[model samples]
Target: MKYEKALLLVLAVTMTIITELDLLPQIHRMGFYCGDPKLSHDYIGDTVTARYLLLISFFIPFLILIDKNLYQSSFSTYLLMYITFIIGYCLCISSVNFFKILFGEPRPHFFDTCKPVEALKCTPGSYVSTFTCTNSDLRRARDSTKSFPSGHSALSTFSAGFVLLYISNKASDWKRIVQVLCIAWILSCTVTRIFDHRHHWWDVLSGIVYGMGLAVITLR
Candidate 1:
């Protein structure tokens, strides 16, 4: 079991690195109409940066686990549980990145990021796929095209959902408060995605469902 878990961890790490490097298959070149209000939002910035979200997602549950098990469980047992949590997190992110590339749904701030060269020439309501971005930042331009399943939503939901399930299995008096906090975090992530013009309602919904599903599977 230890060897199997180690191998799985390695695979998850490799997949995550590949996704972060955008080394997977090319994102689908989805087209958009000229003057589409949906894609016309300005890309201000993330309310919760990716790094911040990841840190909280990891440490919050980790702290909770440690607090709950500090007196009841052995160090080795705690380590094993934390490893499983990591595995679930890695799997969730890798899968979400794959879907983002596959669907290639435009971000709400697509026009701002992409700045399609043909924006001025394309007819209204007509699809325009053949165009180049005017944005000098190549990485941001590339990311603008792959916003199907919000990674933020998926990661946030997965962490909170997983922790909630963990809390539910325990008989501690503080479990209810922790559960409420988890739910609030997930909701906050969802609201920020929309308000920040990062994802559509459907994209957030899909990611939430995806994350929740993985959370249940991980706990099982």
Candidate 2:
């Protein structure tokens, strides 16, 4: 069981590193016009930062799991449940990153982040398939291409969905309230992605669906 946990953790970390390191071929190239308004949004900072999101995802469910299982189950049983939760999260995140790399949909702030060198050379109304980013920050420029299936939305929804399912199995007075809050949290995460100019509506929708699907599978 410890080995299984270690393997899942390693797999998640490896997937993230591969995505961050640009190891995979970003074959799905999306074209854009010289002055496309869709890609011209400003890069404001995230409303829910990665650090906070991670903490919320991990600790909230962890505390709930502890409360739910500690009284009735052995320490090993509780530990296994925690491990399963971590594994589900790892898989959810890894899958999201895989889709982001595979699709290569440009973010709303793509132009701002990438600064393609051929923006001036290409005709204003013509579609451009070939261009190079002149941005000094190569990492940011690379990330500008990976906007499909918002990670924030997917992971947030997954965490909430997981908790909702976990608690729903057992009856409690607070279950309905927590379930409502989870749904609301998912909606907020979806909306913020759009307002942040980080994702389109469809991107967020797909993420939510994916998250919920995985959550159901994990808990089942």
Candidate 3:
């Protein structure tokens, strides 16, 4: 078990490094125009940071108390479980980033990021890939092309789904209500990406699928 735990920890760390290095894949410009910049502009959601903080806060107590109680209070057991969780979380996030860069689907606010001239009009259902973005912020411009899979949805669902799975397994009574609330929260977060114009509906859907799939696999 210790060796398994160490392997998982190493795998998680490797995935984290890969994600941080941005070494997975590059975005391919599709030049797809989904909508006007005015329609795509909206208040950006801060759920990414909020979800990370929530997971850390909740998981620390959960591991120290609930998990400990459930598993003989052994530190090694707790470490193993925690490492497994980290592996799952990192894998889900890194996979999402991989797909996001691989697909290179344009965000709803592509026009704002690209700042292409209106004169180079794209007919409905057609794309104009020949234009360059006028946005000075290179990071933002690059991010605009990585909208295939919503990172917000992916991370939110992964974290929330993992918590839900833990509660389902470890909680005594009232687990059903907690599970329902978790599902609701996950759905709400997924929908917010659409309202924020950071991702399309399909992107959010794919993210949910990927995240939940990873959670289930990890817990199993």
Candidate number of the best TM-score: 1
Cα lDDT tens digits, model 3, 1-220, are 7797678768877986797577765746566543545325643644545455346423532533433444444777666666777888777767777777777777877766656564156665554655566778777777777887877777768777876766654644445555566677677678777877778889989888888888789878
Per-residue lDDT of model 1, residues 129-213, tens digit only: 7778899998899889878898888999999998887766667666777788889889888889999999999899988999989
TM-score of each: 0.93, 0.86, 0.77
Ranking by lDDT: 1, 2, 3
lDDT of each: 0.84, 0.78, 0.67
RMSD of each: 1.8, 2.6, 3.6
- Give, for candidate 3, the lowest lDDT window spanning 10 residues: 60-69
Between which residue pairs do clashes occur in model 2?
none
lDDT of 1: 0.84
